[model samples]
Target: MTTSRLEDLDEANLSPAQKVIYDQILSGPRGIVEGPLRVWLKSPKLADKAQALGAFCRYDTNLPPRLSELAIITTGAVWRAGFEWAVHAPIAIKAGVSPQIAEAIRLGQEPQFEAEDEAAVYAFSRELHENRGVSDATYQRCVAALGEEVTVELVGILGYYTFISMTINAFHVPLPAGASDPFPAK
Candidate 1:
């Protein structure tokens, strides 16, 4: 078994503040403490705030589930964040994203989107991740397709996942048991 890059704290070992945040995560939709949150536990206050933001982006975003998950895997693939990709790829498919589309992103190729909204989300997210900003045309297309509110939430999802991806990468968080890295080194 591969070892985690950081210590994986268990309930028995948690400080009072860490236990509070851990309990909060347990009670949320996540219902488990894993992924970047494991690393975030090192800083309880940061974990609390970030998890709140993440809860909104993951569950309460204005974007449809399909588009939201599309944005998530896009960010994961861009960063080659194995944990993020592994966690979201299945959710994307369950939410109606084609497996082919997710596989294309996994292989670092552009996906062929059958839905215009999916295509728009992909373009908007990919551009923002790769270029640090989206072009006016892409931005306008996203705004037109998703509207200003969801477009903003799309940005939030992208940013939140970026933080998650970076945390996983930085901490060398291990993949779930029996799961291989979806984005292996070239």
Candidate 2:
């Protein structure tokens, strides 16, 4: 297990502000504090705002679960964020994303997407991560297939997961106890 840059805080030791954010997270779909939240807890206000945005991105987005999970795994793989990849890969599969596709991304290879929507998401996310922006053709393809609102939400999901991947990578956040690292050293 990798040592985190920031120590994980106990609920009892939390300040009043930290306790508020902590309680909010506990009440949310994510009932446990882990991943980026551990680092974000160092700043209670940022933790509150980030968790709210993350809740929207992860749960409230218009993007379908499969597509959202695909984007997350892609972003996590791009950054070699072991904890993120480990957590999301199974969720991606459960959301109907192909296991082969997730495995391919984990190995840094092009995925053979079984659906047009999956291909569009993979292309758009790959372009955004690689080139820092998507090409007009890619954007148009996504819009045509997923509609404007979902496309926008897809981008938001991508951006949010990117932030998550960066946070996990930067802090060297470890996988949950007994969970294996999905992305092993190359």
Candidate 3:
């Protein structure tokens, strides 16, 4: 079994600054202080700044949850961020991404998409993650299918989750109890 490099914080032992940040996270849309937030809370100032950006990217972005979650899971797959995939896969599905699509991403394979926008999103995300940037053709496909504004939001979602994935991987964050690693040994 894998163990986290950083120990989880105890709520009762939280410093005042940590408590404040924890409270804000609790009152926010997420209503829970888990995942990378647990790790980020070690540096409260950094947690404050990063969580603010994360809140906007996650809750306030113009990209619909379907597209936003799609970008997130794709980022998770690219990073092999097991914690990220565990958290967001169900959310992606509840927001309309197919189980087949989520599974394909977990396995690093191309999914057969029925919607034009879904196809465009997967392509753009895959290209951005694998190539480090989208080519003109892929960018144009995204903008055409999702419009400039939503496409921009998609980028923000991808970028934010990239940061989250980095945190999860670097900190050796373990999967939640009873949750399997989304990417198992092949």
**Which candidate order results from sorting by lDDT in descending order?**
3, 1, 2
Per-model TM-score on C-alpha atoms: 0.97, 0.96, 0.96
The local distance difference test score of model 3 is 0.92
- lDDT score of model 2? 0.90
- Candidate 3 per-residue lDDT, tens place, 148-175, comes to 9988889888888999999999998888
Q: Is candidate 2 or candidate 3 better by lDDT?
A: 3
| C-alpha lDDT of residue 173 in model 2 | 89
The whole-model C-alpha lDDT of candidate 1 against the native structure comes to 0.91
Query: lDDT score, residue 179, model 3?
Result: 91
Model-by-model lDDT, in order? 0.91, 0.90, 0.92
Q: Which segments of candidate 1 are over 4 A away from where they belong?
A: 1-3
Candidate 2 lDDT score at position 151: 90
> Residue-wise lDDT of candidate 1 within 1-186, one digit each (tens)?
145688788779999999999999999999989989989999999999999999999999888899999999999999888888888999999999999999999998988878889999999999998899999999999999999999999999999999999998888888876778897766
The weakest ten consecutive residues by lDDT in model 2 span 177-186
List runs of model 2 lying over 4 Å from the truth: none
